[model samples]
Target: MLKTTVLNTAHRALGARMVDFGGWEMPLHYGSQIEEHHAVRRDCGMFDVSHMCAVEALGPDVKTFLLRLIANDIGKLKTPGKALYSTLLNEAGGVVDDLIVYYLSDTHYRLVINAGSTDKDLAWMAERLCEWRLDVCLIPLRTGPTAVAMIAVQGPHAKARVWEVLPEVRPATEKPGPFFAVEVGPLCIATTGYTGEEGFELTVPAAQAEDIWNALLAAGVKPCGLGARDTLRLEAGMNLYGQDMDESVSPLDAGLAWTVDLASERDFVGKAALLEKGRQRQFLGLKLLTQGVLRAHQKVVTAQGEGDITSGSFSPTLGCSIAFARLPLGVAIGDRVKVEIRGKRLDAEVTRPLFVRHGKALI
Candidate 1:
């Protein structure tokens, strides 16, 4: 059965082109995808991200359990409500999932995970908690009794616009800097977003999703769908879990080296295996010099060797084809490579993995 979010009816009412995304009925677009993408870049736009799960970890062993699970160090999140992005790894050092962990208190933390990863993530965390004999409760809150709903309001004017509808939340939301969260009554307002723009991702009671959604729309926030969300995150150079990486890909080899804190003496699930498996291929960015749509699974022919494109798309902001590729180590910035598309070869230039941030094109 295809799951539906709390705002499914609202999306259909807005004439959204619905699609089955990760076993869920999701909105592809609210009509014009280009306009929606630009709306987020220029103004403010919102995405119904209710399908994403917010798993809560409570009990005395919560912090210790997390330190032994994800690749990033949780100790860095000393400030309450501070969020840390981490890549949960499997035994062979492959990425199980990438999620955000917010340190709520000494014995409490909240993790936001991908919708598709809901089941596996919860199970994996449970197995570890049991094996470690930790006194912690890992509750998956996207479904079951504690289910919640979420929305992401993004862009340069995102904060101001969101505040217009959530005036009561303004005072508390204003204090959190980047990668932080604050509780505003029933809402968990976080200064975090997938799009490389300033925004807040709000988690509220499932029953209250409609009211908040309607309020944001009345506040002039453009309703965006998964289509614009995909392009926006891709242009921002953020990795999509299943597309850009999976259980077979290592975070160190997937352009996420910075998120891994291997320097610490703390022993995580995949630390030993990760340290053993050094960089096999380099993950970098590419800009096409030719006119063509760059898509995933395309072959990249570098001067040193061959590679495959992990994620690619026509960037609405850059007005060109941009992509992330795991190429041979010899390929460096300023180097040119050929990509195979439709059995034809096109030239592209190697650049930094990050394409844009804060609505400005970096490369």
Candidate 2:
């Protein structure tokens, strides 16, 4: 049986089209997906993201352990409630998973990883702790019964709508530093989001999620679904796992090199291999010039070599097809590549990402 979130009934009541997503029954859309996408871009919209797993790491050596475990530098997070985005890697320098870690204190930290990779992430951490002989405790926080539900309110007016609905949350989040969070009552409001727009991700108790969702809706916050979420994230230049990257791919070749901190003297798990085998492949963005849609696993043919589309789709915001491709080293910006879609060669221009932001096209 597939797992369901606490807000499943509420989503169904709102006429959401539910589908199985990574073992969790999630809403693909409510009525028209395009309308929901435009609602977020023009106003505010909320998404039920409670399916994400939140785990806590405890122990006196938590800071030290995380520095050696993740690719990003934990020391960069100097303030309490500050967050860092990083990727966990294996010995071969391949990506194990990409996650967000929050620094709560010196001895306690919070990690929010993908729900589908929960068991594997826990096992990997346990084995690594054993190997390092580290004195630390990793605890997986249960979301179904005891934990809170998470809602992502995104768009240009997203923050304003959240403030209007829950006036108390703003005082704490108004002057929030970037990538930082503030706790208000039973809610944790963070000023970070996947969409390239101003927003807040709120985490409240599961029992209270329905009330909050209703209140937000009454306050003019549109209810969005997973389909809108994908388009927004893709336009924002953010990567999606299993589509843009996997266990076989490394951060170096996934347009995520900036997240990896190699300058630090800290000895991370895959640092050595990354340093030795880096700079071979490259990641680039593609804008389709032909009248066709680009999808994942499509073949990309370049003059220098061949590559594959990591993530591709007809961008709802841009009204054109776009994709992220892992190409050879010789692939550069302004180069024209051929993408095989339906066994026909379609011309596409290689470019940088961030195709859309703040309801405006950047490409």
Candidate 3:
């Protein structure tokens, strides 16, 4: 059975093209995907992200348990509602899943994980607790009386629109420092986003989603879809799991070395494996010099050796194709490479990731 969000009818009413995304029926676009992408870059746009799973961890040992499970240190979150982005790793240092952990209190923490990986992630966390005999409680926060729906409002004017719609949340949402969140009534407003824009990811009760969405629409916030979300995140140089990485890929090979806190004295999962194979192949950004769309699993040929594109797409903001590739260590910035697209070799340049931000092209 395909799962539907609370706003399914609303999306259809807006003429959004719906598609099956990872077992969930989701909106692909409300008319033109490119137009929606531009709206988020130049103005404000909203996305229905209710399919994402939110889990809460409780117990006095929550912090201690997290320190051992994630690659990033949770102790760094000194203030309440502070958020940390980290990757869960297996014993071999391979990425289990990348997630956002929010510190709510001394004995409480909230986690938001990818929708597709929710079942596996919950099961994995539970099994780890039993195997390690860790004294903690894990709870899955399903959308119901206690849990709620989440919507991501992104773009340059995203905050402004949010303030206009829900004026009562203005004070709390005003000074949400980067990677921080605040709870207002039933809404958890966070100044964080996947797209490289100033925005907020709001979590509200399922029943309240329609009201908020209607208010935002009246406030001139355009309804965006997953198509725009994908393009926007790609332009921002963010990795998409199951495409850019999976359980077989390590953070070190996915251009996420900075997220791994290896220098600290804190112990974490997959630390030993990271230390052992940290200097292998390197992950980098690729700008296609030829007129061709880059796609995942394409072969990349460099002077040093051959590799593959982890994530690739035609950037709507850049008006060109860009990609992330895991290539041999010898390949450096400014180096040229060839990508095999549709049985033809296309020229591309090796460069740093993040091709666009705040409606401007960076590469």
Candidate 4:
């Protein structure tokens, strides 16, 4: 049986077309996927991201445990409620999982990881904790009786809509800049989002999820599903776990070298391997120049060498097909490439990975 989120019934009531996403029964779209996409790009939309797991690390050794656990430097998280994006790597310097770590204090921190990676991530974390024999404790916040549900409100006016829905949180949430979160009563309002838009990710108790969803609905926030979320993230040039990268792919070759801190003397799990192997390929964005929708695993032929499309979709914001491809090194922007679609080769232009951001086309 597939797992369902606490807001499953609410999604069904709203006439959502459900599909199997990983192991979870999630809504693909409520009515129109494109409209939901536009709602986020042009106005405001909300997504039920309750399926994502939240884990809390507590104890005095939390900072020490994190410093050697992930690739990014956690020392930068001096201010409470500031969030950092990092990847957990195996001994081979490949990506184990990409996650967001929020700094609450020296002794406590929170992480929100991809839903599909929850089980393995927890097990790996547990195994590592045992190996290190640290005093810190790993607590899963998305399970058991104390589970929480997360709702992502995105777009230009997303923050304002969240403030209108929960007025009491405004005082706490208004001041934080992007990538910062604040704890207000039962809410953890974070100025963070996947869509390339200003927004807030509201984490609340699972019991209050339905009420919050209804309130957001009543406040005119369009209910988006996984389809729109995927398109939005892809258009924003964000890497999707399992699709854009996995255990075999390094963060450096996946266009995530910035997320990995190699400069500092602080040794992490994959630092040595990353330094030894170095970046092999260039990760870039492809804009289709001809008629045809781009999809993953398509063959891309460039002057440098052959490459593979990692993630591809029709970009509603740009009104064209866009994709992320792992191309051979030395491929430059404005270079023309051929993408094998079916039997015919389609023309595409290589550009920076970002296609659309903040409701505007960057390509």
Candidate 5:
């Protein structure tokens, strides 16, 4: 049986077209996927992201454990509610999972991991903790009495819409800059989001989720689904866990080199392997010049060599088919390439991976 979130009934009541997503029954869209996409881009929209797991690390050795666990330098997160984006890597420098780590204090931290990789991520962290013999406790926050549900409200007007529904949290959430989080009573509001827009990812106790979802809906926040989420993230040039990369792909090869820290003398799980393997491929964006919708795994033949599309779709904001491809390093922006689709080589142009941000087209 597939798992369902606390707001499953609410989603069904909204007439969401449900689909199985990584073993979780999730909404693909309510009525029109395109309209939901435009709603988030032009106005405000909300998504149920309760499937994602939240884990809390507590104990005296928390900082030590995190410093050697993920690839990014967690030392930069000095203030409470500061967040850092990073990847968990294996011994071979492959991406185990990407996550957001929020610092509450030296002895307390929170990690938000992808839903599909939750089990594997927890197991990996457990094994690492045992190996290091650290005095730390990993608490999975998706179940039991303290469970929480995540709601992501996004768009240019997202903040205002959220304020209308959660006026009490406005004082605590208003001052934080992007990537910062603030706690107000039962709410944990983060100025962070998956969509390339101004928004807050609200984490509320599971018991209060339905009320919050209804309040947001009553406040005129359009309910979006996984379909719009995918398109929005793709257009923002963000990498998906299983699609854009996996345990076999390195951060350097998946357009996520920025998330990996290799400068400092500090050693992490995959530092040595990352230094040894280096960057082999270039992760970039493609604009289909010919008449065809780009899809993943299509053969991309460039002057430098052949590559594969990692993520692709017709961008509603751009009104064209765009994709993220792992191409040869020599390929440059403005370079023309050919993608093999249905035995036909379709023309495409290489460009920076980002296609849209803040309701504006970058390409």
Candidate 6:
């Protein structure tokens, strides 16, 4: 039983190549994947991210519930609409999932979690709320009136084009800060994106999904698919949840240590385990020097030891192969290494995990 988003029919009508992505039927590409990737880099492109779960927790105890459930501190959100990225960890210090939480008010917080981890994430939070006797109740966006279409409009021109299509969303986003969200009526627009470009992720009702999609299309925002989304995120140095990190992996090796809040003694889940786990491996960026397609699970041979590539792709913007690898902590930037691609060793170099941001190359 595969799930489908509100844009399922629209994607098929546009001649999109569809595939199973995390149990959801999703578009891999509409036509030329490289063309779609460039469209997002140069102009604006939209992706139907309705498969992602938008779970909202509300109550007087909501803030306290989150403070104990996630690795990051929700107390950091001093202002309304402020969003925080956190790793939801288990009792053993392994990552359960990485999610973005938005503070709407003192009693209301919205969590946009990965589609694959929704069930486990809900169960975990539910048990904790019961145990702590917190009054928080989790509400998934897919149910009832809260059901909405999650669309991502990305690129340097993304925001301007969004205003052209849905002008009503502008006044709410006037504060103009990164990692912040604004709710106008039933619409929730957040100034956050998986791609390293300026964009706003829109959450609108399921009934109005096609209308909004068409409006954006008419406003010159091209339609993109998961294929283009992958290439764009790779160039931008964003992590794909299941591949980059999982329940068996820790944030220390997943290039997500910054999201882990260890400054306070608030006693979040997995804090003790994380303190005991002295990072053995590190997450670093890889640029293939030789001509070849870098793929995941490929063995990387560094001078220190052998490691593996977690996520890899041919970057459309950079016109080269880039990947994220979990390597020995001693692996420094500018260190030469070899990647085993199809039994043939290829030349590569190690650098920082971030490759590009704001449509510009950092490496």
User: What range of 10 consecutive residues in model 2 has the weakest lDDT sum?
Assistant: 139-148
Itemize residue pairs with steric clashes in candidate 6. none
User: Which digits, one per residue and each the tens of the lDDT, describe model 3 over residues 227-339?
Assistant: 99999998888999898878999898998887899998888889999998875788889999989898899999988889999888888888889999999989999998999
Model 2 TM-score (2 dp): 0.97
The segments of candidate 3 whose C-alpha lies over 4 angstroms from its true place after superposition are none
- How are the candidates ranked when ordered by lDDT, highest leading? 5, 4, 1, 6, 3, 2
Q: Model 1 over residues 1-363: C-alpha lDDT tens digits?
A: 899999999999999999999999999999999999999999999999998989889999898999999899998989888999989999999999999999999899999899899899889998998899999988877666567899999999999998888899888888778999998777899999988999999999998899999999998999999989989998888999998889999888898988899887899988888899877889999999989988999999988999999999999999999999999988999899999999999999998878988889999
How far is 102's C-alpha from truth in model 3 (Å)? 0.4
What overall lDDT, based on C-alpha atoms, would model 1 receive against the true structure?
0.91
lDDT tens string, model 4, 1-363? 999999999999999999999899999999999999999999999999988998999998889999999899999998999999999999999999999999999999999999999999999988988999999988988777779999999999898898899999988887889899999888899988999988999999999999999999999999999999999999998999999999999999999999999998999998999999999999999999988999999999999999999999999888899999999999999999999999999999999999889999998
lDDT of 4: 0.94
What's each prediction's clash count? 0, 0, 0, 0, 0, 0
Candidate 2, 1-363: lDDT as tens digits: 999988999999999999999999999999988888888888888899988887889998888899999999988888888998999999888888999999889998988899788889999999989988888998775644657788999988998888888998778888886688877777888877887888998888888889999999999988999898888888889999878878888899998899999987889989999999886678888999989988889999999999989888888888899988889998889999999999899999998866888899888
Error of 5 at 11 (Å): 0.6
- Please, what are the lDDT tens digits per residue for candidate 5 over residues 199-220? 9999999999999999999989
Off by over 4 Å in 6: none
5 or 6: which has the higher lDDT? Answer: 5
Residue 131 in candidate 5, Cα distance off native in Å: 0.4
In model 5, the number of clashes is 0
What is the alpha-carbon lDDT for the whole of candidate 3?
0.90
